[model samples]
Target: MSKQRVLTHIDAAGRPVMVDVSGKAVTARQALAECRVRFPADVAAQLRKSGLRSAKGGIVDAAVIAGTMAVKRTHDLIPFCHPLPIDGIRIAIDWHGERELRIDCMVKTTHRTGVEMEALTGATVAALTVYDMCKALSHAIVIGPAKLVGKRGGKRDVGRVV
Candidate 1:
């Protein structure tokens, strides 16, 4: 025997519907999401020598700014997400290795719904911004595995920042 899991965004008739959060208690919630941007070997070397700046300007700085903005506007972009007043957000873009950049977005809020989507949106948008700014450097640049790393203060709490 197995328990059947119901989709929150779908009604019994199967039409798409937003989840109702009005009855849910408002609480402090946080989510952490991550993404990675990997540059080709040659491009990575060039970036290092030039201090991670493209002709467009500082790559890391731009990603951070874009990610933060995305966190706030997540509701506008995603259909099911509720517009939330963000309590705090931190976007960190750093070198994971010689050729890879890691982007982490942590979002916090006091709301009825969790902020996992917001964090994920922030990290992924930041990665896209990185790719956009560096496209001239190389079309082979890769962005991938945008994922929710952790979340807390909801029906189910999971993971933690170490």
Candidate 2:
């Protein structure tokens, strides 16, 4: 058999594998991710006035709940992920500007693997929830460019864009 590159979460062979983190010491790990939603001026104005609410509930509140749920279930949704016991999850939504809404998710765990995936999933799902809530207002609403803002633990720590 031809030699193959070992994936980060895979074993020596090329076959799919979950990372063995048993030997790694448990440590506090945290990650933050962000996504931005762009809405039309009119929609933005309405949101500001109504505090981003629909008949269902508050848009931000629903998104926060969705984001937290996503964080807990990220391992189940993503392949090659080891189910983890998360310590905490927080989702924050705020207006970045007249037409932009910013969503941030922070995930915490003291485990072998970092919670980067959880944070990313939380942020993305929150943005999606926002899109769903505002779709009735206009199809022009755009969800853009989710990214990791910061991470700490493991071999390295990352900081946000300066």
Candidate 3:
């Protein structure tokens, strides 16, 4: 039989609570997360022809800026996240195929807790920003499959993309 996994953000009474990291050893940690935005077929062609610019501005640049900002404020957005003094944040946006754009966010910090949440939040927000900027072009755009590509530190290291 496998071991039962315990949730760290709940008390014995099952009330939602932030996980305590005060007693944990401080360590250098990092995480990478990704989200994708899929444009409609016609929209992709137009975007490519226009060098990824829209009426709002440069689509990729706006996403990168929004993603970096979100990474720094993840604690304020998420109920259980600890405020981390981030060491670095990187957001990359690029075409994955013919009609889909991929966003990757990587966060680094030296702290008692991990930064996977920060990475996830950043990537997701970035993808959303893209959708918002391009909504005028089409309402058929889709964003999804957000996931943690990798993380390091805490109880154990997970995945490996970063």
If both were scored by lDDT, which would come out higher, candidate 1 or candidate 3?
A: 3
User: After superposition, which runs of candidate 1 have C-alpha atoms over 4 Å from their true positions?
Assistant: 1-3
lDDT by residue (1-162, candidate 3, tens digit) is 988999988899999999888899999999999999999999999999989999999999999999999999999999989999999999999999999999999999999999999999999999999998899999999998999999988788889955
Candidate that would win on lDDT: 3
Report, for every candidate in turn, its global Cα lDDT versus the true structure: 0.92, 0.88, 0.94
Residue-level lDDT of model 2, residues 34-145, one tens digit each, is: 9999999999999899978976679999899999999999988999777889998888899998999999999889998898888989999999999998898889999978
TM-score of predicted structure 3: 0.97
Model 2 vs. true fold: TM:
0.89
Q: Looking at candidate 1, what is the lDDT of residue 5?
A: 80
CA deviation > 4 Å runs, candidate 3: none
Error of 2 at 96 (Å): 0.3
Candidate 2: regions farther than 4 A off: 1-6, 10-13, 160-162
- List of clashing residue pairs for candidate 1: none
Per-residue C-alpha lDDT of model 1 across residues 60-111, encoded as one tens digit per residue: 8998899999999999999888999999999988889899999999999999
Worst 10 residues of 2 by lDDT: 5-14
